[model samples]
Target: MCAKQDDAGAPHHHGPGTERDTDGSDRFEVDQEVQHALDRLTLLINAAEALSSTLEVDQGLRRLCRTLVPGLADWCAVDLLDDHGRLRRIVVEHRDADVTAPGLDEGLLPPTEGSAASVARALLGVGPVLLTDFPPPKDEDDPLCLREKQLFERLEADTAVVAPLRARRQVLGVLTLARTRREVRLTEDTLSLVEDLAHRVALAVDNARLHAEAQHTAERLQRSLLPELPTDGPLEVAARYQPASTTARVGGDWYDAFVLPDGAMALIIGDIAGHDLRAAVMMSQTRNMLRGIACDRKEPPGKILARLDAAHHILYPHQTLTCIYALVERLSADEPWLLHYAVAGHPAPLLVTHDGETRFLTGGRSLMLGVEPEVHRPAATDMLPPNSTVLLYTDGLVERREEDLDRGLARLRQHAAALAREPLTTFCDEILEGMAGGGSDDVALITVRTAPPHAGPAVATP
Candidate 1:
């Protein structure tokens, strides 16, 4: 016997003629085992990397199919349940050198009534599945059997192994791998490896799905909470809400505009402290309370916010909020071009003149709402030129990870200056779009452009 070193550096004995003998059968067997282990490890590592690389569902699925095909199977396909709970074939991978797999051709695939997908239904339970044995088509005349045969021919698949990609009892999708020839049966170890890969794929799919669903929900809620722009007025309002690329961070960033009972147009924008259900609820309360104060007391912009700050301190002592509340009123009948407003604990509203000049109304700074309410003061007395556009937004518009708030404000001023010639609606949307790229926070921009006296009714732009 001859001794050989294991992976842990421990000495292990090999049979006779195995020591330092390249031609020995024992050496060959050991080499084959070590090579198989390495291959399995490589496959596992690649699979994990592929799954962790992206949060996009379609992209992840496509990568998963590509990872498995031509390496572990002759063909791979993933069928996912759509919004209607019907299984839709989303990705198909084939190991053909001469031909590409079919695209999303709905006609080429049969419905999920009685198909291999039915086998995947078993995954709705616990543990992984290994369906090694499958019955042959009962009859050539059967439509289901014919469809299955056609599908196999198209992908050049023979024996198939179906695994359910499940996460926390939710069936995300089904992963199917098939061989090109019936004689190429899958070994137990190979099936086990594939099952493990399927579990990882399931987790990735679940994460992506959850993210998309959350974004969709957040967008809907944000839109609903946002006030609709006024139809008839000298004030032109445009608002846009862009969520951060990170789906989990979606929250209560909102803009509001309406004509107060005193005839002054109220423009308000605010951001809650956190990005969760708590923030959304707080935002709703704050907006409603502000509206009530504006209507009942007909208070000045500064006083309304001060009162709101006091109330919030009493209600939510631990939470914080930043807001810009401006009450716009025409200076006089003849001076339709001049508009006056106020601000509090928020980004200074930008004043963009018709001549492409941009100005920030940074009169002063005050404490954010709900923090030392009595000590905080609201800034007042800012005016805009006629036909001038005033942009009100949350701090998210000008706050970046590595950059200071001043730099963000300067960037906004530059963009607004460039877009000053554009329509108020278009300019507002463009500014938000430009500033919202590359890991920026959620942005809420409200542009109120004082329309010329002769201009038509005001319209709201997204």
Candidate 2:
């Protein structure tokens, strides 16, 4: 049977060949060839559309399979090279509805050494490989040859083409297209078209892979920089750090909770000026400096931040930072938690009572860090009653462009009051979802609820 054109103007070939004319005269060979080219072009356009359909590497590769199989080829497979240059069959698919072998579910294939498969040769970066006929199964007991024989038999492939998937002039993977009972005559023009399609697919796959790797590395570094909150005392601490969602830029927001040299605990949240790798690096530096100064000086939060303000000029000049450094101290579990904190152009910490009353702790506000080292930042004190929650956060939590800062603060207090009785993790999550969801800036928050004597030990959430 022949094919017909769909509403989208793309030819849909059921088995191959063309439908006879009404007069029963054969169509010109050149016209048939032109129709085939147009059909292949439409398929290529659809394949390009699927390139950025997903950011995941595996899903992006599989999208190529779904786009090509049953339309341009009866079978399609993608083989990618690992970091160690080993061939991994990432995707394998056929037009048969029931056939499932040689699919993505199976693991890595054997190494490509001494293999007759065109996929292996294409990976060598020489050029495309076109096989008009399937080679006879080898007599030797080589595992790859036996595997190739099995694949050929199962897919009933009569012809195949393997093209290199390259990025930055380096081979990253191989694309294989196979034909079964309805043979595809891959002339020079058709081979060139397939190679062009493979070109676009390779770039998309490479870009996705690189992006995933970079995001993973950044996450690892960010996690390493954020130390665990203390969970062994009267204080229950929960902290969260979310990168900006608007763009690929990594922000500088960070939170830290650590024990001072004294018995007191220190909580710090800060944001450097920029939103890139440099800002992230500076954020780590500033956080460490504040921690070290607090531990070594054994002073109140204000003096430690003052020291950081001075040292910031020497360590990383021409940069600005906003931070809130607070120290939690108590003689015993029976007493209420005493919070001594200092802020440098940062949002005031919120104090939520156990009974759902909420208010911002608007004391000790000062100029942003590195503005002027000579200006001494003062400290303020607040007595957080047992079962009260104190929230330290960066401005990203309550600074939206659509409204005034005061309005954002009011909204935050409203939601926080409603969620005051929830667990620390749930409390932080709900507040973030309610207030900071889809905000352009990065967010860093630390919520600590003073546990009463009856309650068990404090817990920390990631």
Return the top candidate by lDDT: 2
Candidate 2 per-residue lDDT over residues 1-462, each given as its tens digit: 555799998878663223345223444666787997789788878887778787776777778788888887888887788888887878787887577654533457777788766666787785577777776656464555666667767778777778999889889888888888554655455578778988998899888878878876776777677887776876788988777765454768899998776778898888898877888888887887887788787887888888999999787777889999999888775677899999999988999999999988989989998788889899999998778899988888899888998899899999999998999999989988998888898888998888875788776776
lDDT of 2 at 144: 58
Model 2 residue 96 distance off true place after TM-score fit, in angstroms: 9.3
Estimate TM-scores for all models: 0.79, 0.69
Identify the leading candidate in terms of TM-score: 1
Tell me the lDDT of model 2 at 334: 67
Model 2: lDDT to the true structure: 0.81
